[model samples]
Target: MPAWTDRALLCLLLAAPAGLFLGCSEGTGAEDVGIVCDPGEGQMCTCASGLGSVAWCRIDGTGFLPCECEAGDEGFGGETAGDGDGDGDGDTGDGDGDGDTGDGDGETGDGDTGDGDADTGDGDGDGDPILDQACYPGPNDDYSVCFPIVVPAPLPAGYDYPAPYQGNPNYRAPVRYLDLDAIDQSAQVAANFTLDEFAQSWKGRYAVLQPHAVAYVQDLRDVVGPISVNSGYRPPAYNAMVGGAGSSRHIYGDGFDLDPIEVPLATLEAACSNNAGFLVEYESHVHCDWRNVDVDVGFFGLPNGDAPNELPLLAASLEQDPHTGHWSAPASGFDEGEPVRRWTAFAADDRVLTQARGRTFEAPPETAYVEVLVGARMRLVGEPLSRRE
Candidate 1:
């Protein structure tokens, strides 16, 4: 499979009307030609009656074959003598033949509601609104039609995020990804999310609602006031493609990368410190995740243990472990008289060290300080976990 980042690629049940029935059209052989099945009172059934014509069974099972309604004869099914069933009544009648007029008039009395077109049910003879028509071939068919109620406009202000689509207005917009297929599979998106704002993707496309994570977000929102979501709920394939850890919490819908647009990075970090199960600082974003795992407060270069809040030396050297291929070093390279901060490396590329720890140690080779703060505390204070990378 192609990497997630390389391609970043790719990517209703309605109820039928009551008493309505549909049957498979039998072959056109004489023995197979049965009487048109009536759809019954207040119901209708349509079928292909001619090359380009339609047949309808109206109220009281009076079936009408397609008509041209021109200035000529009955043109359609208005056969004057019998229903072609050889009963000899020409019209659909009770066969009483006392000059009954074949109108079926009184049959519209108490049986029909308004204009006496019993088929209209609330009968103005208009039938139901075209959009309001219930499932045509019953709700289970592949082609059932329905007019769903759409709540539009301000209700869903953002086209990107899923928090709003999850049906809770209180949750902010820009949820990154919403799994709509998951909704169809379960017939409902998790109770917390709605189906509208969801977008399509390649695989494992769904959002999960972990209450603790939600609460942590709520807390951050409370302090920072509407943080924008940068990333959330990555499919495992996507996570890997994007250079995320194979076991990233995001794969499980438990992590969030938020944009500190309206608040200071320090403020956001402080908020995370107070609420998150795991808090990490990245180059351009802050990562927070909630899980029941026991871990300490991870402070990523946030000036822990007498460390200065100032930026580290830009050209500082780093050391890399040949065996594990990991890097570790202090935040600052200056000696005793200079402002120095220790580094506990989490993840490192040839140029940048990613995670933070309490004490200074050996840094990764071929790396330079990028001033990126990505700190992660595992199950205890000062001890950071590097698995997030």
Candidate 2:
């Protein structure tokens, strides 16, 4: 017989009858004589459990092998594998599949096992995050304390001043009150004045100090030098105890009777004229109040003594959206004359989080406070909305 090649021998074996069984190679058998598919080809098939599986052709280019089901075949029924809800349905709980505590609402949970609630403690239910309510540091490296922006109705028992003073617009109730017992008495409220210095001779520990008054004193200090606060906030009862004028500005928390230490009294009077809203020249001291001044009450200093003239103070009322929890300022009538130039957001540690040019500011996540710089000179700080848990 002629010397046959491997290809010819395989063709002869494939041409034999079905009854003539013969094994060719390790991967080929007599049952593989008829071509079922190309070699190494694969197709989808149903397994014994009615689940889809993969089947590949034999190496000899004949019939396909048995369908092979992959691991985790139970999860192929419209669910993810390793989902540990104990139900094996793959629908409840968070998609992380770790099986931690969740709300089981088919949405991703924060592991608190409760529905989405803000817990901000503002009683508004607006869903804003809690913030730090501590006293923030000021620009002069001093501590700046604040009170809640909302004024209480039916003024506190001892705070309602007597008579015609109550009807006067300038003698209206304070925006908020501060508890002296809870605050540090030695805290530097301004560049040159301490909280104790301002609270001296006051009627009670609970008092109010207008921020504009502090800014005015700081401005005078910049112009002259170290000055002394002879008198600061004097509530109605304290004013009467000292035989003060019935309409004294001291009761308003914006008046300061200051005595200069080094500079001449005339120089202090001149500085007060340039910075104060109302000025009274006394023999040994000068009484100044910012009741008529239109400036940024929240700001501490006027750089280089350059205060904006006729500029209105920026309003601090922030309206919050009930659904979105975003804050927006009211339309300042000064939009045509002195528009808001910048909006800034700050964290609890006084970190600058974001800045924008629009009047509306959406605080970033974990923001503690928001402020706006208006007319390029005035800065108004909004009230802290939430308290940290």
CA lDDT of 345 in candidate 2?
Answer: 82
What is the TM-score of each predicted model, taking all chains together? 0.31, 0.40
lDDT of candidate 1 at residue 25, scale 0 to 100: 25
Q: Indicate which candidate wins on TM-score.
A: 2
Clashes of each: 25, 0
Off by over 4 Å in 2: 1-157, 162-168, 294-389
Q: lDDT winner among the candidates? A: 2
- Minimum summed lDDT over a 10-residue window in model 2 is located at 6-15
Candidate 1 error regions (>4 Å):
1-179, 182-203, 293-389
| Model 1 agreement with the true structure over 1-389: per-residue lDDT tens digits | 10111100100011233422322222222232332323211112211232111122232222321221112222122323223222213222222221111223323332432223432232111222111111111122221221122112232221233322123222222222333343343222222222221223343444433323544565576678767766766655556667665345555455777767677876887888787455665546677776332111110000111212231122333344456644443333221112222353333453335445433344444333323222432221122223324
